[model samples]
Target: MIRTFAFDVGETLVRDDRYWASWADWLHVPRHTVSALVGAVVARGQDNAEALRLIQPGIDPSAAYQAREEAGRGEHLDETDVYEDVRPALSALREAGARVIIAGNQTVKAGALLRALDLPADLIATSGEWGVAKPSPAFFERLVAQADVPADEILYVGDHPQNDILPAQAAGLRTAHVRRGPWGCLWADDPTVIEAADHRIDSLTDLIPLAGQ
Candidate 1:
């Protein structure tokens, strides 16, 4: 039985429109341009941040991020940034006696912003806080330890195939691929993603019944 439901933040519980928009503003580039570049990189199985590097060659994303933070324009999340299904889904799962956790590859500031929203989750964490990012076995190792349960009893849900589904599966966690974001939609039908994910969902609400099973 899946006793714990762990969610990925970006494009899973939250929409990333504001994130890319912020970057566009930071770089003084058109939002659509950044969007298109992001799509192109994602289609090529490249990192989403590659779009930024494409915008400004030799740019240091970490340095840019810190500069944005200094300018008071770093990562920000509000209720509007969250998916409509997130609250109800998380609350319902918690109400059903399932452990609800929100963990993903996000900055520490993103973690703080997520907590400020007060979503119905038992725990919220990020890669920055953990000092480990996804697609890494060590990251899932931390998650497994935090869940304090057998990895198979924990369901790791995300919109990224490589970072979420494959790695989580390799770490012994049951995986769910949510087809909402660009990567999710593009790769949803791929044999690899389909074969890796134990469940394919379009919305967080879809997991409500899955938790009961």
Candidate 2:
């Protein structure tokens, strides 16, 4: 029985394609170019913080990212959604007796996505707050401690194999590969990236059954 669940926000819980497209439009750059910049940096697989900085210089990408999130709370939220099914999915998980929590490896505005979603996150594990990024196992450690759950009883669902999946698996937590098609899985399947998950869900609503502890 899974006692708790930690969800990743960007690609996992919230789907905001237009926001980036808007940026691409604003920057007069191809969306694929932006995607390639991120992909190239991620291919290097450096520390999470370093990776965010490598792709975006000058501004602390993490902090700048969060600022955008904060701004979204007031406006720009229409560009995204927390996934209409999220509430029912989380409610179903709770009905099955699982505590739902939110965690992310955002540079700065990691918390903003959760806040915008207005989900009742029992705990939030953010990379910006910890100053370390994912796949390090540190961010998961913080969230697990904050949620006060035994590692084995907690399940983490995410789109990023390195940032969310592997680290959670290493922390002794069960992992559910939330394969969201485009965002992160464009290269290959989630297993290709993490290769350690115990389960797979193509959508957020699929977690209904495992919410039971």
Question: Backbone clash tally for model 2?
Answer: 4
TM-score for each model: 0.97, 0.75
lDDT of 2 by residue, 12-53 (tens): 766655555544454457876665565566567644345345
User: Quick one: best TM-score, which candidate?
Assistant: 1
**lDDT tens digits by residue: candidate 1, 103-152:** 99999988999999999999999999999999999999999999999999
What lDDT does each candidate get?
0.93, 0.67
Off by over 4 Å in 2: 40-79, 107-110, 187-195
Clashes of each: 0, 4
Residue pairs with clashing backbones, model 2: 62-107, 62-108, 66-109, 96-212
Q: How accurate is candidate 2 locally (lDDT)?
A: 0.67
Q: Give, for candidate 1, the lowest lDDT window spanning 10 residues.
A: 204-213
